[model samples]
Target: MIYQDTFGFAQQQDEQDELKSFRDEFLFPQHNGHKVIYLCGNSLGLQPKSAGQYIKIQLDNWENFAVEGWFMGDDPWLSYHKALLPTLSGLLGANDREITVMNSLTVNLHLLMVSFYKPTNKRFKILMEAGAFPSDQYAVESQVRFHGFNPKEAIIEVTPRAGEVTLRTADIIAQIEDNADEIALVLFSGINYYTGQLFDMESIVKAGHKAGAMVGLDLAHAAGNVPLQLHNWGADFASWCSYKYMNSGPGGISGAFVHERHFANDKLNRFAGWWGYRRDKQFLMQPGFDPELGAQGWNVSTSPVVLMAMHKASLDIFEKAGGIVPLRKKGDLLTGYLEYLINNINQKQGEEVYRIITPKDQKDRGSQLSVVCKRDARAIFDYLAQNGIIGDWREPDVIRLSPVPLYNSFTDIYHAAEGLFKALGATNA
Candidate 1:
């Protein structure tokens, strides 16, 4: 698709968009009495207009049924999360039994590590991408320490070659082979948070397993942003937060995936709780932790009905929008248009004013473009914010602009580019 750097072209594309109607399902924040151009879905998704009604339904059930709402409501609180599994299973490309909506991301990561990250005196190291999200870095470090290994010695980060912004799949596979003798686990994010580079998870899983290690993924950016096949890829476990691309609201409930191949493996350990106890005998309050049949076994506490309701509201939209396949189709075009416009700005300026660090190929990225401003980065970011073009800024110099497919429009991307161009003159940098 040819892209033009004019507002008219953007309006024209918006007119032709098959998913254009989805933009109305969300409630955007206002700036000076108009809707702000929201390009920060990489950080936080806009609220779904139907979220309130979903929550209110559960609220009404609570009010009317009192404590009995656990079993009496339209969606019984006890089995409420089950309703979410079908859509989630489709999104993650796994069996419904392999998925469970549970705690937040990092917490689930730590819990999964307990079962997958079993290190020994000789094979006690974890191989992961360098510059992983801070929460993941901290969790791996603490887990290493808890197992009596110094983090400095137990952690192996695969860094890019000098002057490179992304990892080559060959380098990643070679690293796994090089460290095979000692590596106990291969942990990675589906998409790097900082550079917006989508990792080749299928290749990573194969390499890790061949190297005699378990594989896990942190899909916070990738779950709703890209396609996944955890079961088919043979990933041992994975987890993701719902607040960002999944758009379940701030601190929303998270989901975990455990391949069915591991379900009968008794050697694996879990930090068990009654919520995960055998469902048939849960009401009996029996002793000895007998876990539920599948991924639900990972649940450590009762489901948070309110948060799940918010999650359901958003998942329902994904279903209506025909799942991630269609969303991804539009996302590629929207992101490509933004990259094209930003490139035009640099070409017109006769210098690289904004260097996009995200991969140029659509196959290697989702909706985000991480741009490094040549000068006055903070000032330029503030200018965009002041102009009601809301993107997010990373530390140091990068600005992340994500044109989410569910709610963002082509016009939004056009005006955001306009703001980036105007910021240069306004900041005088």
Candidate 2:
């Protein structure tokens, strides 16, 4: 493929992009009368223009109907979440019965663990990546403690070998096989929040099952960024936040998935609430709890219509853009182009000044590239921000740049690279 350093090449690519029109649907941040080069969609996505309209309809229903809105309204509040499943299911690669939108990300993680992380005397360990997000670590630790097991004894963490920044698939599979006898659950992120490495979900799920353990994924960074097949992979459970790639607003409602095979397993325990009760008998307000079948059975409270409205607006965009496959194809090219530019800049410098922590294999990563600078990383990051290039900086020294397929254009990538090149020279101390 021919590569060009000029913005004209990026503009040409944008013209050829099948999903180019999506850029207009979002509210891009502005700086100095120019749209900021927004490469932070992996942290928080741009707001969809349609989100306002969707929320307005709900606001109107609340104004006109008041309490009656629950039972008698266009798109009744009681089942508002139902309309979201068809679109969400497509993103998750799950059956409609296997997925539901409710609760926040960490909350759903705990709830899913309650049902799937059943510990026995022989098999009582929980396995995870060593450098998992602190929230996940805390959740796993608490879950183990709740079951009267010390986290030190019951939690097994796998780390990358020395001189390696990313985990090898073969090593991960081997660890699962070695610990199969003692592990009750294998939980990992589909994409690491910091490294932006996309795990082999299907292979990991299969490996966990072979060892007689349930497999689950925290997809906060993976959902909507990559194609998934949760049902086909027979994954035990998965959970994700919608604020990032899903493009719902901050602290938006989260989603969960449970394999259909587990739907009929009455023995699986859960922390129940009224929302999980059968809809037909819900208004009856009976004493006994008859849970709804499938993933809805996991819900603990009534759906939040306002949040669902914003989510529905974003989902509509996903539907209009076709699906994850086409978006991922574009993502590969966009991210690869960014990598190319970064590497070119590094070559121009005497030594390797910048390093991309994300995997080189297209299948092993999503849109985000975690760049680790060898010198003055923070100063360089701040310089990029001041120049109207918006990417996020993690602690110590990592700048995460995500070129989202929905709103980000090839031109954005080109501009971001140019800003980085300028910053490198200007900010050197």
Candidate 3:
């Protein structure tokens, strides 16, 4: 699709957007009494307008039912997360029994590793993409050390070829094959947080399985942003934070998926809590850990009702929007417009003042475009802030702008590009 470099063109696109009214569902941050162009949904999603109301219902249940709220209320706190599974199942492409909501992103990652990353002396190493999010890096390093192996020896990082900004699928598969002997686990992010490169999870899973290793994904950036068939892909396990694309509140409850194949496997280890006990006998206060049938067996604590309420509020909107298929359609065009405008700026300037390090192919990325400003990177970011364009910044350079399909409009992307264009002149002076 050819894009025109004009505000009118952007407005026209927004006008034709079928999901345009969905923007009104979220509460945007204000700037100078106006809604800012919020392009940081990749970091923290905008809050849904109904979030407070949803929380109030839970608050009311607590007030009316007191200690009985856990079992007596219309939506019992004991099984609150059960209400979320259908929508989440659709978003994640998993069966209702395969997914469960619990813990934060990194915490779930550690919990899952306890089960999936058991390594013998020969195949003790973990293979991952280079430059994984710092939390994952720390988690893997500590997990390796806890098992009495040096991180430098136990972690194999698959990096891009010297000049490339993204990993080629062949390189990733070849690396998995190259380390087949010593690698016990293959862990990767569904989308690299830094480069916004969406990895080929299906190919990666098939390769890792053939090489005799378990594969898992940290879907912090991928979960709701991209369509995932975790079960069909045969990934052993995966986890994601809801605060980003799922639009649960900041530090919202995270979720995990375990393939149905793992459900009956007694060989897997877990650090269990009462919440994971079989629901019927959980209240009997039994001794031996009789785990729940599926992913819920991984739950280590009681449900956080208010957070689940907040999450349900957002998922309701996704369900109303007909899930991700329609949202992704508008998202691609919105992101494409921003990329086209940035490239046009470079062409007119007669130099590559802004280099997009994210993959150029639509299939290889989501809404994020990580643009490295060749000049005045910091000042330019500040200028966008002042003008109510809120894209996040990485250290040294690279302004990360993500046009969220839920709340962000095509006009938002256009104005953000306009602010960036003006920032060039503002910084020059």
Candidate 4:
């Protein structure tokens, strides 16, 4: 397809998109009797039209079956989560036994840490990216404190070189090798939330294991945005929230992955509850806990069926769209087009007024582009909001825009650039 600076080009792209019909499945917000250009899927995804129906099915089962819904209905409440396993596993590139949907994002992070971050005097330090999400920082700090270690001394953070917005894989691997004796764990976001940088997961996992350290990932931003091979990469554990690219709605249930290697290893310590007990003997109310064989054993309570219903609705869409590969292909083209237009604007303005902090190479980033405004950042952001362009602004000066392939169009990218140019002109005036 010949790229052109016209809405017709986006219309042509949409016409050629095999997954374009999927956009109708979402509930797009409206402003001034028009559909708002939503570029914030990196933050919260649009709700699926099927979500209401999915929830209603569960509500009906709950109202009619009442207490008996746990075991009696066609899709019993107890096994409702089982229906989602195949789809979730496919998305993570993991075995069914290694993946499960449960808890919120931060809660799952702590639970996975409990089993994986076993620190001792000789190798007690945890290495992580320098600017991890605040919640992750808090969780790791509390986990360190729980073991009676000072976070300042026990947490080792890897940062980018001066004037660089993203971390280099070589630097990360080198740090692991240098601290091989002191580091007990390596936990990083599969994709950095602010910079949209996709970390080298396979190499990092290999390096950590070679150094005798366990590795885990907080995939909150990476989950549906990029293709992952958690099982093949031999990652020790991982966790992710579903509300962003997965379109599971706000505060939807999250998921976790525990490598099958740990399934039979009884020595792997974890915080367990009744739900984690063996299913056949759970009702026996045994004196001791014999955990379930795999990732399901990580569950602490009954699965939330209502939230799972919404998640299942989104996964159904993913299945119909032919999984992540095709979507990622379209994502690359869409985001690349956005980058092209933005750089063109910088040239026209005669100075670099806005800079994309995300890496230029598609291999190093996901769908998001973090634009750093040189001046009048807030005013430019406010103008975009008033003009019906919906992207998110991080603290200080970054505005994140993600062109999700499932719903966003190339025209969305074009209009965003046009709106930004107008906003910049207004600020100067």
* Local distance difference test, each candidate: 0.95, 0.93, 0.94, 0.92
Clashes of each: 0, 0, 0, 0
Candidates in order: C-alpha RMSD to true structure: 0.7, 1.0, 0.7, 0.9
Name the lDDT of candidate 1.
0.95
Writing each residue's lDDT as its tens digit, candidate 4 over 1-429 gives 356777788778888888889999999889788888999999999999999999999999999999899998889988888889888888899999998889999999999999999999899999999999999999999999999999999999999999898999999999999999999999999999999999999999999999999999999999988999999999999999999999999999999999999999988888999888888888999898899888999999888999999999999999899998988988889899888888888998999988999999999888899999999999999999998999999989999999998999888889998888899889889
- Looking at candidate 2, the ten consecutive residues that score lowest on lDDT are 1-10
lDDT (10s digit) by residue, model 2, range 381-415: 99999999999999899999999999999999999
What is the model-wide C-alpha lDDT for candidate 4? 0.92
Per-model TM-score on C-alpha atoms: 0.99, 0.98, 0.99, 0.99
Model 3 misplacement above 4 A: none
Question: Please, what are the lDDT tens digits per residue for candidate 3 over residues 318-343?
Answer: 99999988888878888999999999
Top candidate by lDDT: 1
Minimum summed lDDT over a 10-residue window in model 4 is located at 1-10
Whole-model lDDT, model 3: 0.94
lDDT ranking from best candidate downward: 1, 3, 2, 4
Expressed as tens digits, the lDDT of each residue in 37-81 for candidate 1 is 999998899999999999999999999998999999679999999
Task: Score candidate 2 by lDDT.
Answer: 0.93
Please list all clashing residue pairs in model 1, or write none if there are none: none
Model 3: ten consecutive residues of lowest lDDT: 324-333
Roughly what TM-score does model 2 have, to 2 decimal places? Answer: 0.98
Error of 4 at 333 (Å): 1.0
